[model samples]
Target: MLETILKSAFEWRNQLGLLNESEALRIFYGPGESNHPELQHLSADLYKDHLWLTAWKKISSKVLDEACEIMTRILPFKIEAIVLMDRSVVASEAEVVTLRGTSRSGRFAVKEFGVKYLVQMEKTKHPGLFLDHSPLRFWLQQTQKNKTVLNLFSYTGSLSVAAAHGGARKVTTLDLSKHTIEWAKENWANSGFSPEAGDFIYGDTFEWLPKFKKRGEQFDTILCDPPSFSRSKNGVF
Candidate 1:
């Protein structure tokens, strides 16, 4: 059963672009005889091919990691901001990030000069740093040089800190949960930034967004990363 399953999985993998690069059929099962374990026996020569087994294991591991990295690169950050399952993140600066997972957290500086952003996976659904929104943040930094920025549904306020570093006039954050707001504030402070630069508002975003918009008040720049789906007494937004 195991051998049959493995063979079928390999065939499916080839169909899925996982093993399409190589002619696996020619390499694994030449015209000499059956190379599939399922067509042979448990202790057959095919099963005893230590080199083939080792190669398959290594290649599979590599492919899995590569696939994950590609997916992570494009996957949008979830609107819901929660604690890292067994890890945490600290932004040392606009160009530097530190990720501490269940085992360890380390800092790495990144610049768009010529290097790719270093992504750190953590316990949170989101990795330590969000990369997909790189374009959005870059634009904010350029256009919000001296404008007040409001970041709603701001989990870590990574955007807030980015704006501050980019010389935003002011940054305000509103989140119903106090803990997430505090963490956002902490991240801002960790970069040697001023607490005064940010005002953490603790409340429901739906109530706060409309209220702020109604006060004849508006920020020069606003960055809102709202949950995919949310509900309130007023209605779902």
Candidate 2:
């Protein structure tokens, strides 16, 4: 496992084009007594202060929060916050709400302006984060006023809440899982946005999307984050 982690870190370094290769290598190995003097420059303190464990799911919540703090320090503009949500939706005592449900079972979670601006986890090997799109959230805050926004695959509806904060006229969220939609509603409520401000649709987006299009309806803004692959009640859309 350790060898795999080191290999993964090396691959990550290569992919990211990080300038400090040795420093990253030191983090991958962890602090050891037999380290060289130059490697001594790479201390746990240094790594802990800047490096993030965005992909570590088994890590405890406290450690993940610390990592997110470090990640914000490293890339603040790319992250507004981080959270770890798993099948066990309830964590950190954040108020939870049940929106809808499916035959099989899944859930979503929401947190208020609690603290850290980014979260890391590994429920499905994808962190509960969309840091790559933080810039778009800021865009919404700056431009989306009195406009309706539709968040498809609204996993937790963070965008919907952000739109409401930006004075969106209304928002609609669609997702397959009832638990997630419910969690999104809770998040909207926690953001001090009225539940009525955004309508929650629980079912296949394929069915919903064309229906809205056929109604000659349009959204001021639309956001989509489809899973790498998924199937809907109607067909693969």
TM-score to native of every candidate shown? 0.50, 0.51
Which predicted model would earn the best TM-score?
Answer: 2
How does candidate 1 fare on TM-score? 0.50
Give every collision pair in model 2. Answer: 80-117, 81-117, 81-118, 82-117, 82-118, 82-119, 83-119, 99-182, 100-178, 101-178
Stretches of candidate 1 above 4 Å error?
A: 1-102, 105-123, 230-237
- CA RMSD, predictions in order: 15.6, 12.5
**Tens-digit lDDT track of model 2 for 1-237:** 333433454456457644232211123322342133222222221121223222212334454344334434443133322333232333343322211111111222322222112222223323233544555666777778999999999876767777788889999999987866776777677567776788998988877889998998899999988876566666664
lDDT of each: 0.47, 0.51
Which pairs, if any, clash in model 1? 85-123, 99-105, 100-105
Residue 80 CA displacement from its true place in model 1, Å: 28
Q: Which candidate is the best by lDDT?
A: 2
